[model samples]
Target: MTASNDIDALAAMLLVRELESALSAREDCGFQLLSSGQEAVAVGVAAALLAQDQLLCSGRSIAPALARGLDPGRVMAELIGRASGPCLGRGGRGHLSQPSAGFFGAHAVVAGNLSIAAGVALALQARLDRSIAVCLFGDGACGAGALHETMNIAALWQLPLLLVCDNNLYSVSTPRAAALAPQRLSDLAAPFGIKACTVDGMDVRSVRGAAVALTDHVRSGGGPAFLECVSRRFASHSTSARETRGQQELAADRELDPITRLEKALLLEGALSTQTALGLREQVRARVTAACAFAEASPLPVPDEAFADVG
Candidate 1:
C-alpha cells in the first residue's frame, strides 16, 4: 500500500470504530451488532471493490456500510429511525441499503444474503459488465445449507461472486470450534473447487491484499473465491445481548483490536505521526458527532410513512 493508502486505510478503520463507539453510547442506539474488534475485515474488503461492484453483508454491518462509502449521516439516520435515512427509516439498522452506491444492503439473517448475492452475481454475469457480487457474512453462516448451494452453483456456473467470512471466533455464546465442523472455514469452499485463502482479520492490509487478488480473479471470470478473516469481537453479540465471555477473555480480545493494531503499524512504519493519529481520531469523532446531529435533526417517521414506500 502507498503511504497515502495506508493512512487512508487507517482512517477508514477509525471511522468505523468511532462511529460504532458513538452509537453504542447512545440511549436509543437500538440492538446494534457493533464491529468493535473487527473493523479491518470490513475496511479491507471494501478497499478492493470498484464503484460497479456490489456488496452484501450480514447484520453486523455498520463497518461494512461506512467502509462502502455510505454517508455517515444517512447511515446514522437509518439506525436512529429517522425519515432521511437511506431506506427512509423503514429498513432500520438491520437492513441498511443503498444499491446505487454498490452496497446491496445488510440482512439480519445468518446466511440469508448468500443466495441473494449469487442471484445478483448471475444478473451481473448476464450483463457482462465484469462486475461481481460480494457477500460479507460470518462464520455462523457457514453451518447453513444456503452456503453449500451458493458455492455449488457459483462454481458450476462460474459466477462472479466473492464470499467473505468475517469469522470472529464465536457465534453468540458458542465458540466456533464447538459448533463448526470444518477444521478451517475456508475449506468449505474447496469442495466446490473455489479458490480460497485465510488471512489475519486483525490486519487490514492482509485482508485488502487478498480481496484485491480474489476480486480480480472473480471479475476475470475465474469463478468464485472465498476468503476467511479470523478476527476478534470485543463486545457481546448485540447491545442488548449479554457478554458471555469471561473478563480475561474480553481483555485478551481487546489486545487484538484491529484499529489499534493498524495505527501502531502505521506509526512504526513512519506512515503516521502521533500528532496526525490524534488528529485523525478527533476528525473522526467530529464526523460521527455531526452524523448524530443529522440524525437528531431529522424527525422520526410518522405512522403514515409506514405505507409510503409500500406498494
Candidate 2:
C-alpha cells in the first residue's frame, strides 16, 4: 500500500481521471449522480487493497469500483442499461462488479453484503488461506441490524474482514445525525471487541495508510477491524433522487474535492510534475476508451444463460 512517490502520484492521477470520465459518461446517460464527490473515499481505501483482495462494496461507490479495476465503458454501459456491461447488463450501476478484479459486488439493499463478506471469509478459511475481505458500506447501513449481527460473527470467528463505513453524513437526504445515534461509525465495532479507526475519507493517502494498517491487523489473525471514512456526496443520491431534491448543497463539499486534494498533495510533495500528471491522466483516459470499445464489440449473453447460471 505504501507506494513510492512516482507510483503514488501515477495511481492518484489515473484514478481521478478515470472517475471523471466515467461520471461524465453516466451523466450523458441522463443520470445526474453523486459519485464524483466521494472519489477520495474510494481512491484512498482502494489504494490500500492488493489486487488479490476482494471488495464487497455498497451502492454508493461507483468511483471506488472503477479504481478497483472495473471497466469504465462497461460500467457506464451498465449504468445506462446497455447490453455490454460487467454484469451482462443484468445489474445496473448500483449492482456492478468484476469478480476477476476482486470486486465481488455491491447491493442496493442496506448492509446486504455484510454477511456475504463473512461468507467469502469463511470460504477462504475453509481453504486455510489468508486472503482478506474488505467491505465498504455507508454510515446509514451501520444502523441496520445486519451490521450488528455480522460484527458479532466476524469478531467471534476472527475473520479477516475490514469493514469500512463511508460516513458521508447522508442517507438519501436524511442526514447521518438524524438517523444514527452513534456519532462515529467505528464505535459500532467496540461491542464485538473489534479494532476500529477513523480516517479522513477525503484524503486518499490517509485512507490508504489506515487501510494498510487494518489489513495487516486482519492478516495477523486478528478479528474484524472497522474504519469509518467521513466523505461527502457531491450530487444527489441517485439519478432520479437528484432530480427530486434539486441537489442538496453543502458547505462541507468545498473543503474536500478528492481529485484536486490528491493532485495538490502530489504537487506539494513534489511527487510528480504537472506534465507527468497530465500524461498519466491521458493514459487513463485512453485505457478507459479502449475498454469501452472492447466491451461494445463483445457478444451479448446467449438467451440460455438464464438457465445456465441458475443454481
Candidate 3:
C-alpha cells in the first residue's frame, strides 16, 4: 500500500475499535455492533471514493460512515438516541445518514439498499457526471431477490455502481455454505456481465487495491462492479442474538483481526513504531470515551419533534 493508503488503513482500524468500544459500553439502546472484523472493506472502499461518491452501508454495520470520517460524537449520539445525532436521533445506528459527507445512510433490511443504490446510480448517470454509488451489504444478502433485480438493472443501464459484499462467512448463525449456493458470491454478477472479484477482506492493502481498480473501472464507464470480501465478524450478529459462538471460535476469528494484521504489517515495513501504535490505540479509546460522554450529556429528541421529519 502507498503511504496514504497505510494511514487510511490505520484510521479505519482505529475507528472500528473505537466504535466497538463505544457500542459495548453504551447502556441505552440495543443497537447492533459495528462491523468488527470487517473494517478493511469500508476503509479501503471509502479511500478509493471521491467526495461526490455516495456510500450506502448495511444494517449491521456502521464502519462505512466512520471510515468516511463522520464525527464519532454524532455517531455515538445516534446510538444513544440523542437529538444531536446525524438523523436527529430518529434513525439510530441502523440508519445513519450524512449526505454532506456522501454517506447515504444504512438500511436495516437485508439487501434493502441494493435497489436504492441502483436508483442513485441512475440519477448520477442521468446527470452525465462521474459520480458513483457504492452499496455495502453482507453475504447473507446475496440470496435476496432485490440484489438480483438491482444488478440486472444496474448492468442493463450500465450504472456506475459498486456492490461490496462483506462476506464474513456467516449469515447470523448460519454459515455461508448453508446460506449461499455459489462458492463465490462475486460469481452471481457474471450473469449480468458485470466485472466481479473476491478479495481478502482481512488485508487492508488487498481490499484497497481491488476497490481502487474497480471504482476506477466503474468511473470510466466500464459498468458496475461487485467485490466479495471474505472476512469474519468478531461479535454476535446483534445484541439480541442468543448464540455468541464458542470461545474457541471467537478466538479463531480474532486471529484474523484486521487491526492486528495491519499493525504488524506497518511495523514490519517501518511505517509505524510500536510506541506510536499503542499511542494511536489509546488516542482512539479516549476519543470514544469523550464521544460517549457527549452523547450522554445531550438531550433526548423532543416528543413532538418525531412528527417533524416525517413526510
Candidate 4:
C-alpha cells in the first residue's frame, strides 16, 4: 500500500477505537458500540465510493459515517444525546444521517434500509445520475424478505446498487451456522442474477479491492452486486450483553483483528513506523476527548421541538 493508503487505514482504525472509547465511557445514556470489529468493512467500502454516491448503513454500523468524514464531535454528541448531534440528538447513534456527506442514514430495523437503498438507486437511475447507492447490512438481515425483494427489484431494474453484507458469523448470539442455510451468504445473490463475491473482512485491502471492482461494475450499468465480508464480532452485541463466545473463539478472532493486521502490514511495509503509529493513535484519542467534551457541554433539545420535525 502507498503511504496515503496506509495513513487512511490508520486513521480509520483510530476513529473506530476512539469512538468505542467515548461510547464506553458515557454514563448519561445507554448507547451501543457495534463498530469495534467491523471497522475494515466500513473503511474499505467508503474508500471505494465516490463523494456523490449515497450510503445506507445498517443499525450496528456507524464507522462508515466517520469514514465518509462526518464530524466526530457531532457523532459523539448524537450518541450522548446532545442537541448539537447530527440527528438533533433525537435519533442518537442508531440513526445518524449526514446528507452533505452522502450518508443517507443508518437504520435500526434489520434489512429496513435495503428497500430504501433500492428506491434511492431507482431515483438516481431515473435522473441518469452516475452516482450509485451502497447499502451495508449484516448476515442477520439476509434472512429478511426485504433483502430478497430489494435484490430482485434491483436486479430486474438494473439499478446501480451495491449490497455489502458484513457477515460477522453470529447474529446477536446465534451462530450463523444455526441461522443461515447456505454455506456462503453471497450465494443468495446467485438466484437473482446479481454478481457476487466474498472477501476477508479482517483485511482492509481485500475488502477494498472487492468493493472497487463490484462498485465499478454497478457504476458501468451492470446490475447490483453483492459482497459478503466474512468478519468476526470482537465485542458483545450490545453493552447489556456479556460476551457469548468462548475464550478460545475470542482469541482466535482477535488473531485476525483488522486493526492489528493493518498495523502489522504497515510496519512490515515500512509505510508506518511504530512511533508514527503511536502518534496517530494519540491524535485520534485527543480528538475523541474533545468530542466528548463537546457532547457534555452541548445543550439538550427543547421539548417543544420534539414534534417540529415529525412530519
Candidate 4: where are CA atoms >4 Å away?
A: none
Q: How accurate is candidate 2 locally (lDDT)?
A: 0.74
Best-to-worst order by lDDT is 1, 4, 3, 2
Q: Write the per-residue lDDT of candidate 3 for residues 174-287, one digit (tens) a residue.
A: 889988899799999999999999999988888889999999999999999999999888778887776647999989989998888888888998988899888878888888
Alpha-carbon error at 38 in model 4, in Å?
A: 1.0
Output the better candidate (1/3) by lDDT.
1
Among the numbered candidates, top TM-score falls to 1
Clashes of 1: 0
Q: Is candidate 1 or candidate 4 better by TM-score?
A: 1
In model 3, the Cα lDDT at residue 158 comes to 92
Alpha-carbon shift of residue 294 in model 1 (angstroms) = 0.6
Which consecutive 10 residues in model 1 have the weakest lDDT in total?
Answer: 302-311
TM-score of each: 0.98, 0.87, 0.96, 0.97
- Please give the RMSD to the true structure for each candidate, in Å: 0.9, 3.0, 1.3, 1.2
Whole-model lDDT, candidate 4?
Answer: 0.87
**Clashing residue pairs, backbone N/CA/C < 3 A, model 3:** none
Model 4, range 1-311, lDDT digits (tens) per residue? 46798588778877877787668866774858568878899888888888889998888756877887888889888877789998888987679888778988798888899999999899888867689999999999989999899999999999999999999988888999999899899999999999999999989999999999999999999989999999987888877777889999988998988998989888998888999999988899888888788888899898988888776
Q: Highest lDDT, which number?
A: 1
Model 1, position 311: C-alpha lDDT score: 72
